[model samples]
Target chain A: MSSKAFKQPWTLRTASSVFVIAWLILAAFPFLWTLWGSFKVELDFFSKADWRNALTGARTMAEHGSSFTGNGYSGAWVQEEFWRAVFNTAIVCFFTVAISLTIGTLGGYALSRSSYRYTFWLLITALIFRAMPPITLVAGYLLPFFEWNLWGILPTTIVVLVAINQPFTLWMLHSFFQKIPKELDESAKVDGCTQFQAFRHVIIPVMWPGVITTGLFSFLLAYNDFAVTSMLLEKENQTMVPKIASFLGTTQTEGNVMFAVAAVVSATAPLFILVMFFQRQIVSGLTQGAVKG
Target chain B: MKHKTFFWFILPTALAMLLFIALPIVSVITQSLFTPHEQVFKTVENCTPFKCTQSTTIDQEATEALREAQPLGRFVGLSIYLDRGHLAFGEVAQAWQSRDGFGDFFNKIGNLPFYRAMAFTLSYTFVVTPLLIILGFMIAVAVNSLHRHLKGLVIFFSLLPMIVSPLIGSLVLFWMVDSRGVLGTGLQWLLSNPDLSLKASTGLTWIMLMVYGVWHSAPFAFVVFYAGLQTLPKDTLESAMIDGATRWQQIRYVVIPHLMPLVTFVALIQLMDNFRVFEPIVGFNAEAHAQSLSWFIFNDLGGETRLLSSASASSVLTILGVAILLSPVLIRTWRDFNSKG
Candidate 1:
């Protein structure tokens, strides 16, 4: 190396730092803006006269005699029954994650442990299914579910979500399980335990962290989904996302956009906190798919 | 593991995938080939010395009887795929015979509902994929260079867009980009044109959708690349420095080659994701200007009419398109497996 080779200059360094920070702000600011706006009155948030009122909540405070108001929240929660959708979402996400992880853990463990050639095909098949848009599958389910009188119910949507989530869950957990050394479970088997017993006594504790990470993803899928839930669930059975969407469709014209706004904030609050706490898992879960692929 | 154990383990998922994923695809294909039976009608006439009356009435009994027998409707045999809503072969042939140039033909064809959605979906996919990759690579590099203490904060915020639901993310941006909102006003001020608005133009709306696409997905790329960067061997980089390779040269030759697999992985994933661009179109209320195949299916399945057959046709086409896009990955995976064996 030449002695005259210059270090990256302080000016360029500062510029790069500013650029990164600016990018982060660009990434995160819109949510914050909407979050703040959700507390204000419609006239202020979507201020026609001046956009600055959205930030300042000027008219909101003037009307309500406070800088912040929960009127939108009340309208969404009480009048719109947004809580129903929230409860439905919780049930759907919980069972979707639970059922998927239960079956997926066993399936993934099997796929990863086996030395047969079918494992490759199984993983490949799952990957292909993972690439498929769930809405397409929703089309298939409609006729049958309708025939079976299973359409438009929370359990129906939950089962469908679990099915839709199975591919990604299998693929993700398969990879995670593959990372665990084969020897631990093999030793358990050699120690006179059956395969299930080996997995239960030896691998369950080691497998939990990976399962949780994968469960987070499954929960995200169930929670964030709009296409399947909206199409599959009856109006009364709608989850938070589809409910918010239905609000936009039905209520947007009625000048009750604030209810939708409040609903969006309520929905986003949990995800915000989830990312804040589980940023590491979310980050790794995202990358693990790429790097391992 | 024993064969019985393996069978037991894979059965549930296999059944689920078979019933939901595989069955749906087959059902959609079958549905595409068939169309719902139309109402049977007959015209009856009554004649008299002074007046004659003719009436066309639906034969409700006959219609219901036929529908009961064939619940899937009448067999159309690929007619639906070739109809006005899908491939538009008739439209294409007419345009070809019109003696117009390619531009005029395209203009006429692009106005067709299915093609219009395809046009936007394809444009969104191609444009968004490259832009996000470049943006992600740049951000990954910058973040990789940042001081360790500040990295966590920046990363925490960066993941929010990717973490949030597509509907919420799009709604947040949609409000901002609305004419009355901050970004739209900011744009108007920048352009010194009070009339400027994203919603008023197709091009601007498309740009806004793509921008949302990039914002939502770039962090996936960034985090992947950042992780890839960590595994870049230090000895090779220092040796490159010793060989007088400039910083740009380092990235172009060494760093890029090291991250090539991850680049391909990200590209493949983003292609699949962007191909199914639905939520943003709905969130932005841009259906007037933009729609994707998924949106096409959603539209068909919803609304008062509930055109199940049409949605099924779109679903089949979408699956075919995904298969085409995914062939490369499958081939690569197969090759990798064979090499390992």
Candidate 2:
């Protein structure tokens, strides 16, 4: 243990605070703004004059009365369309993560354990799939679904969205699962554990951090997936992002302050919760999974 | 016993990948060549002809001599690369390469927006990647000098950008810069001016978006560097320090050379990732800015264009670009793996 920096507490604290605050603001300001924007009224946002209306003061709140509620700070917080977007986004996120992880982990495990002649090729192919742009996949395959009349499968766009994300999930999760030593599996099996049981009891616990990291990433990737979702889903199936984006585009015509309010309401707290809880695992996962790979 | 279980274990992964990831991509490229959507082209054959010629006709009149002429060439096969007059495909495949089944496909890709997208994407990747590595290196060195626990905390903080959904994260930034948001509002008041918008301007927006991309991306770099820093050999660093080397000098000599392998890996992955900068750019463009290749590809999917072929062609181009750019990295990693084995 190299315990060296204890003598210079004040200097270290100041430096760390400066780095942390600046980085946090730059990294998180957009999400914070979304939180605040979701509560604003039409009048405040209308002229683009009140775009700077900070929610810190009571005067702004009083002036923007109908938009601000006690619980949500926005009176019209419970719109059906807003909830529908949230629901739709949740559905997409759910399926995307579920399907991707199951395949990713299984594939990652096989690659890690088996000394196949083409293992490297499989790994590299997975990396390429992960690396290729999502737009390319969506663009290339949008027609196949249309041709199959699978365009009706929640829009041709969603199908593309689901497909594009699969490769990423596979590669990231596979790499994470690979990091656990196989000796643990071998030893567990020798001690009367079957292969599946060894995986369940021995390998899984060790890889939990990786799983969390990968799952969180996949979830974020799916949730934050805007391009494919926006392109694929129509007005009814549009996820939260496109709904918010569409509203932002039509704010003048719609005269709805609550959409921005809705953007804030739907995303802010859940995202913050994810960050606050999974911060450590997510960081390790990123460094190990992406940067060092 | 060994053979049966091994097959079982490997079967699912191989089959899934073959079915899902590999097959679709391979099919996209091949399908583009053979099948032109009936809606978009009359036939893949008549997309553009090799040459043009003038013709004249005279009515069959008594006691009048008439002459007529037309292009005196036979219909060529899809091979024999004829010049398709599109700037997107450029002239590399136009002159001599196109006399095969791949000629029309090459010429078609030559004329599409795919090439411009590739140029734009490659430029974006090239510009942003070095900037990330350099900045991340600086931050990693600065953080490394701090106490261990505190250093870990700082590194984690920097990495939050990686954790958040880019859709939510990037879009939030987009709103924050909007005239009505916090930064926008603060700026407007500070300037005390109406019509002084930050994001509305293209030059500023482009720079700002790049900054956002860097900001979101640098954390991964920082973490990798930090991890490399942790595993770095201490004796070498100590030897440099004992020679009365300054901290910067020690780092430049001892730390950086040690970190090169990690550096190469990070750079290659980032290059691949950045060239595919679809989501963030699309998110930015959704709020109205310049278009990116990904956005164009996405938009092209909806129209009467031959999206599958176009997208496949673009994807193939991107994959090739990535492969070419990162060939050194690939070679190095391969060598490292082989040597270790």
Candidate 3:
């Protein structure tokens, strides 16, 4: 470490430090600023009077006799019923991860275990599906889903999310299951275990690390989904993203901009927490998929 | 495992993909060929002692019935692809025959929906991918250059932008960049021009969208490249130092070649992502000033009048564009698979 430090010249060290500091600031400052401003009244945050009022929280202090208040949170959560979206998002993310992982694990395990040639073509098809945007699928789903009266519910969107998520989940899990030696399964078979028993006993316990990582991604996919949920789900059943988009579309004039701000903060809170807990897994999962696939 | 067992294991996911993913492509292609039926119209004339009166009116009931009877409407083949809102072959020919200047021709082309969205989508994909890659690589190298302990902290913060919902991230940026919001107000003050607004101009809106794109996705690239950096050969670096290589030269000669595969990985993913730059346009409310192919489809399918045919056409075009961009990566993957086998 000492030798490495000495290799860097003073000029180069200063430049890199400057760049790193600037990048951290650029990366973090917007969310931090928005988070702070979410508690302020609209005038203070927006501050047509003076931009400095935003930092100072002048109007927030003036309006509520405090530097910050929960007016926005209350307005969005209680008044606007944004908690419905929170509930919907939870449901969507939960089922999307569960369903995708269940099917993806089986399919991926099969692909990894099999020496058949069609598995290659099957994986290739999944890759192509991954490359296609969800909005394109939404275009097709509109006609059929509407006709079948399946549009606008949580379940339909969940299935769609799981299906769209399959390619990545399958690939990730396939590679992960590949890492477990075939000898483990063969040995289990020699010990009088059926294939399902071999999988249930030998695979599931060892699969959690990869499964959890892939599950986290699936959760993000469902949670972050906007186009499909917006296009498919009904107004009453809108998720957080489409709900926030609706705020952008209609509600600025009612002086309810703070509601949107609070909602944005509320929605982003989980991701912030997710990163805090799973930084290592998330980073490794990302690079593992990229470098390999 | 027996073939039957393997088949059962893979069946559920294959069915899901077939019903949802594969079928959607087929349905989109089918939907694209057909146009919605036109409203039925009738003209009536009455002759009186002094003068004749005539009237034309839409038969709404008949039109509705027609629509109900044939929901997919009449198959127009490739006509929808070449109409004024899409390819606009006729209008383009007129523009060409009129010998309009390139700028004027482009302006006319921009009036076409498909061309306009294509222009933005292509430019956004090309511009954002490279910028994010360079910025991300710089951040990665800088972070890698630091002490190992600070790496975790920096990465935790970096993940925020990339992991946050793109819609939410864009909204956050959009609100901050509103003319009355902090960044916009600060910019106006710094420039001494109160009229400087992101929403008021085309170029500024595009720039803001690109800024949001880089701000959000660059972290993904950074994390990947940073991981790649850890595997850099110690012997090669020590040899470079012994040969009097500067930091820049070491990076250019040794680091980049090693990171090339990772670079392609990032590039492929970024092109696929940036090509579908839909949420930012919606979040920024910049649809009036800018649009993408994905946004075009969204707008058509939305509202009271669902233009299913138009949206499907846009979707097909977008898929084709992705296929074109993705072919190189696909071929490489195929070659790698074959070589390994």
Best model number under DockQ: 3
lDDT at A282, model 3: 95
User: For model 2 chain A, where is the 10-residue window of minimal lDDT?
Assistant: A68-77
Lowest-lDDT window of 10 residues in candidate 3 chain A?
A1-10
User: Interface Cα RMSD per model, in Å?
Assistant: 1.8, 3.8, 1.1
User: Per-residue error at B263 for model 3, in Å?
Assistant: 0.5
**Which CAPRI tier for candidate 1?**
medium
TM-score for chain B of each model, two decimals: 0.96, 0.72, 0.93
Backbone clashes (count) for model 1: 0
Docking quality of model 2: it rates as: acceptable
User: How would you encode candidate 2's per-residue C-alpha lDDT over B72-95 as one tens digit per residue?
Assistant: 112332321122311223364453
For model 2, how does the per-residue alpha-carbon lDDT over A1-293 read when each residue is reduced to its tens digit? 36362233566557755765676666555555555545544444323544444454333476645445333333223543567777887887777667656656766676667665566666666666666665555544455555565543453443444456556665666666666777899998899987778877987778766766777877887777666676566678877776666665554645354555556456656666777788777767666654444
Worst 10 residues of 1 chain A by lDDT: A1-10
lDDT of the structure predicted as candidate 3: 0.90
- Supply candidate 2's per-residue lDDT for A277: 80
List fnat, each candidate: 0.76, 0.40, 0.80
Number of colliding residue pairs in each model: 0, 20, 0
Question: What DockQ would candidate 3 receive versus the native complex?
Answer: 0.80
Q: Candidate 3 residues B159-245, lDDT tens each?
A: 999999999999999988999898898899899998999999999999999999999999999999999998888889778978998
